[model samples]
Target: MDEARDYIRAMGGGLLIGLPLLFTQEVWQHAVLLPAWKILLLLGLAAIVVIGYNAINGFRADATIGEVVVDSVEAMGIGTIVAFVALLALGRIDGGSSVRDIVGHVALESIPIAFGASLSRAQLSGAGDDEGREEDRRGGQTKSESEAGRLGPFQRLLVAAGGALLFALNVAPTEEPVFIGVGASPVMLLGVMALSLVVTLALVFFAEFGGRRHVSQGILDRPIPETIAAYVISLLVAWTLLWSFGRVDGASVVAITGMVVSLGLVASLGAAVGRLLVASGGEREDG
Candidate 1:
């Protein structure tokens, strides 16, 4: 059960951190333009980072050198799978694509995802509060629950907005969302909105991350409503960024809505994960 939870946390963390990059056009272009040798070198560097991270603060306590190596490989594998699926979903790579192209795309996107996976437990699983989490899993009150007051509604909204901005800031200024929006049909764009809400709910409620124990259940705090509210906040943040970046000026309503929804997918995930990390007391300032 513990191992399953760890794997889930790793995957959730990877998606939360790596999803934005999948929407990045530059990454797609790099996958196509960079040579195989360069890809291999990038993969090598990613490996080193993953291994070093696992050696210091892996999912398992007191893991040996061999265990660290195995964990690193596992992280990379998870990341590669995530990149592959996301790329396929985004229509960045299709069956007609050559094996080399697919491999290149997956490898490039997997690096940051693998980094997220490698640090998943340390960053998202409340490493500093293991005892509390264990107690939480056993249905006991958590440290955060006992010590910290639940975040109010306004605070939750603010955190969601801030997180949405952090996630969408770079993507909002780019043309990828516009390109995707213009190409997609209205139905497809609505699918994007649906997907955003689904992913956000999964990340915050169903992923079973450690911080979940601290999520408040006040007004508009139930899973479905909270998810919807966060998504709305994300869309608003997306619109603000798009407008400020001049990406939406003089655009059709359909086009603007599509862009907002495209960016909202990642923005919603950011809001959900950020609430877990920040509001639930999983995050700590580094000295």
Candidate 2:
């Protein structure tokens, strides 16, 4: 009964985060057109993310490695079922669709949904207090907390990159980035970049969004340096994703840079959220 309840909550959380993409026309298009290798790679990457998330903030506390693995698989399964059912209900998946089409579409869309499912405990359950108390009783920081503090510069870059990728993937296939780039002047673009940096800093270091905590008290936790570093990472991720989607294939350097900056705004916001999500626990005062 407990397990069933958790699954139901996870499905609900998945739907909350995944519904927009599930109905997105570009996402559906990508489902049918993305290459097999890309699809497979996405699935593998999703598994790793789900497992890593489960290890820290999963529904089950102190979950063993084997248990985290099982839960990750189960979350993916739940995400798949939810995606198929929603698509079918919306008439997006008709009976006339081929097996390959149906499978590919559901499989591709399931990755994000599954990731949301894996995050249900942290995002949906409102159980952080209990979990924090448990960690305190254990007499030291949990494994996730410990590791978050010890992350090197490269790891911080990777965290920002992953966040940018996850968020950028949602809108990259759409025309919004292109449209934004086309309409904005150079001055406007510069304003947008400044705004993105300010917002990223506020959210990650200054703002109190749900009493969330920072992972480390190191140099990266400082507003100026972390903001600069994360913004750079976001730009890199935006550039790479844009290139991969062929959005900048024949574009001029200025055009490409503008598109990357436009998308980097969104990616920076995502990086902030990602930092909060992966940081393991709530704010702690210096003792």
Give me the candidate number with maximum lDDT: 2
Q: Record all residue pairs in model 1 with backbone atoms less than 3 Å apart, i.e. clashing.
A: none
State the weakest 10-residue window (summed lDDT) of model 1. Answer: 278-287
Please, what is the whole-model Cα lDDT of each candidate in the order they appear?
A: 0.72, 0.73
Model 2 misplacement above 4 A? 56-61, 127-162, 210-218, 284-287
Off by over 4 Å in 1: 1-145, 214-217, 282-287
TM-score of each: 0.50, 0.80
Instruction: Assess candidate 1 and give its lDDT.
Output: 0.72
Best by TM-score: 2
